[model samples]
Structure formats: C-alpha cells, structure tokens
Target: MSKYVIGDIHGGFKALLQVLKKVAIENEDQLIFLGDYVDGWSESPQVIDFLIDLNKKYNCIFLRGNHDALLCDYLKNGNYTEEWFIHGGKSTLDAYKTLDSVTITQHIQFLENLKDYHLDNFNRLFIHAGFTNIKGIEFEYFKPLFYWDRTLWELALAFDNNLKVSDNNYPNRLKLYNEIYIGHTPVTRINKTIPVNKACIWNLDTGAAFSGPLTIMNIDTKEFWQSDPLPQLYPNENGRN
Candidate 1:
C-alpha cells in the first residue's frame, strides 16, 4: 500500500478534493493529513465532516493542529477570546454555531482526539505547528507552537545543523525526531528545507486557505501535487500565508 502525506487543508474542502483527485488515491494506500483540517476557509464544517468520513472509510492518520486545539477549547469553554479568534478561531465558531450543539461537540471531540503528532517505526513523523522537543509527543506544546514566532524556525534554519531547541524558550535545533512532516507555518509554495535529514523533511502547507495553493506529496515516492484556491476562496486567511 502506498503512503501519502497532505499539507494543511485549512478548510479548503473543495480544493482538498481536487488535490485528492490528482493523487488518485488507491484503496490500498493510506493518507495522512499533517493538520489544520479546519478554520481559515469557509468550509470548516465540510472539512471536518469529510475527515471524519474518510477516517471511517479508509486507512488514514490525522494529526491535531493548533486550529483544531482552539476548536476543542471553544467547545468546552465557549470563551471566544481575541487571541484565538484572531487566528481563524472566529470563523470556526461561526461555522460551528450553525450546527446543533450535539454535532458541534462531537466534532470538537474528534478534533481533540487527534494526537499532537504521529510517528512510525520507519523514520517518519507527522506534526503540526513545529514541535520543539519532537523526540516525543507533547500536547502541552501545541499552544506555543501554534502562536509561536516563525522567526524561531527561521533562526534554526540559519544556524549550524548541530544546534538544538532549548527548553527555556530559546531557539535551538533539538534535532527533529524523524523525517518530520509538519504544517502550520504557511509558505508561498511547497517550500522544503531539511536542516538534518538532507531534504527529507517536507513542509507541505502550501497556504491554500491563504490564497497560495494546496499541496500534497507522496512521502514514499516524492510526487508533488498542488491546486490553487477557488477565486476568493480565502480572503481572510490570505493575510499571513
């Protein structure tokens, strides 16, 4: 069976479908989404429902993203605070409010149940928002990773390969666990730079909901697929991506 990894969906359900079509998913194949399945785009509900359905229908792995975490918090706390909402949490709440409380709660739990990261014995890892101590899973770091400054990663990228991420909030490269597949940091395109793996790490988030493009890459085959957003499909998330 072939293994696949998709970039951040960011609620671009339609675009996601298009990319899936290009990949021509096979029944024997397994697909893993790096996260950001909801939020940013207007189709948060559609994306969540699609993911839930896909997991039941096929072999798939979904990682929890910062946006997904905010959704869980909102469901339990109903605190639509500014910091979270400003990062696409507002749009998620708007879409969720349209559904009944029961369905919303179910979706929240589904999203929350997603692990902060996924790792296989075969030198592969799936993560969202770049974890500092990627040697293992750390759900507590999700918040900081989500709201973290990209400058940290940028600095890490610039320094020597031996650098490591410090526990005291200092930016050092802790040597990412495996060939990590992470999202949350938006890019103009499917840009990739592996500080340790000699280009094995892939940053697939092509910024679809940010008006850039949706990205999907087969981890085993190194095949790249992309689809641009439908016109105005993402006017808001377009800000940072």
Candidate 2:
C-alpha cells in the first residue's frame, strides 16, 4: 500500500489526470492532495467533481488551502474578496453552468471536512501551507497552519512559545515529527529546487498551476515522480506562480 503525496491541483484536472496515468497509480494506492484543489485553471467546477468521484473510488486525503478557504467563504457568505477572484476564482465560476442550492451546500460541506494537516502513515505529515511560530494548541491551529508564510516557517522553527530573553533563529533545533509535506507555494519550475525542506517540513508545491509539472512523491521508497510540464497561463515567463 504505497501512499503518494500530490502537489497543488488548482483546477488543472487534465494535468492531474496525466500525472496519475504517468504514475500508473493503482486502486489500492493512497493519495493525499496538498491543497488548492480549485481555482486558477479554467476547470474549477470539473476539478471538484472529479475529485469527489475519485474519493468514492480511491483513498484520497484532501486538505484545505487558502484558495479553498476563499471559495468556502464565498459560498457561505455569498460574497468573497477581490483577491480570491483575481487569484483564479473567476475561471472556477465559469466551470459550472448552474449549481442548485443543494449542490452548493454539499460542496461547501465537503471542503469543510478537509483538514489543515494530515499525518501520513502516522509518520509523514501533510499540510496545505505551513504552520505558525507558536507551539501547543496554536501550532495545530488550521488557519495559520494552512496559510503560513516564509517568515512564519522561519519563526515556527525558531521559537518555542515562551521566548527566553535570548533566542536566535535556530531552524535545526526544532522538530517533533519525521517529515511534513506541503503545497501552496509554486516551486519556480519542474523539479526545481528539489523538495524545500527545513528539518522536518517539506514543501511539495510543484507549480502545476503555473504550467509546471505535477509531482508525486512515494513515501515508502523516498523517491519522486513527475508529470510532463503542463501549460502555464502566467505571462511573466517566471517559473514560479
């Protein structure tokens, strides 16, 4: 029973399917999606439907990314900020011709169940984004844990709740798990920079939304697999999106 941790699939269903095919994934295999399941690409609605179907057929663990959070807010509150729409929510709305009230409610419920962190094989942890600098209950909090920035990751590894009057940014000094895998930050290019790791934390966002490869890392063998480079919509020509 091999478990594959996938990178962000932000409405790039075609690229995701191609990557799964390339991996020759089996029914028994378990897959954990890091997050950003919708938005960015032109097929947000279809991507969500496909993922729902996949859940019925295979073992899949879905986590909540920042984009997913925005969609949830829009559906529940009837309005979301311009930032979400600008960051690929428009294409997501374009996917559905007309979703009934029941459908809308169900989709939001599904998204709500997604966790901010998942411990694979009870050893490997998966999160949409990074964790906060605080420990104890705050470290496990979903919002900050799923949307942390570089500064947070650095701080998370630096301080332990109560700061001693004298403390420095000691990344290597902090760790409580074997490995933590995450997505949300595009990796500049296909297989670019390898896996971003800070001791136990591992960043696996392979930039699929930016037309980069969809990555699948095998936990048992400590090996990696990738799909062909997908098309990018960004005009800057920069690798990371």
For this target, which candidate reaches the highest TM-score against the unseen true structure? Answer: 2
lDDT of each: 0.67, 0.69
Supply candidate 2's per-residue lDDT for 239: 26
State every prediction's TM-score relative to the real structure. Answer: 0.79, 0.80
- Over 4 Å off in model 1, which ranges? 134-152, 159-178, 189-200, 230-241
Report how far residue 189 has shifted in candidate 2, in Å.
Answer: 8.0
Best by lDDT: 2
- Across 124-187, the per-residue lDDT of candidate 1 in tens digits comes to 7677755544334454454546333254345435545453344454332334454667677765
Q: How many clashes (backbone N, Cα, C below 3 Å) per candidate?
A: 6, 0
Which pairs clash inside model 1?
Answer: 164-172, 164-173, 164-174, 165-172, 165-173, 165-174
Candidate 2 residue lDDT tens string, 1-241? 8888888878777767777777767899898888888887776666777888899999999888888888888778767667776777777665543777777777888888887778655766677777654452235544655654454445444445564424564443245456777777775633463455545566777777776767778866767777666564333322224
> Where does candidate 2 stray beyond 4 Å?
134-142, 152-169, 189-194, 232-241
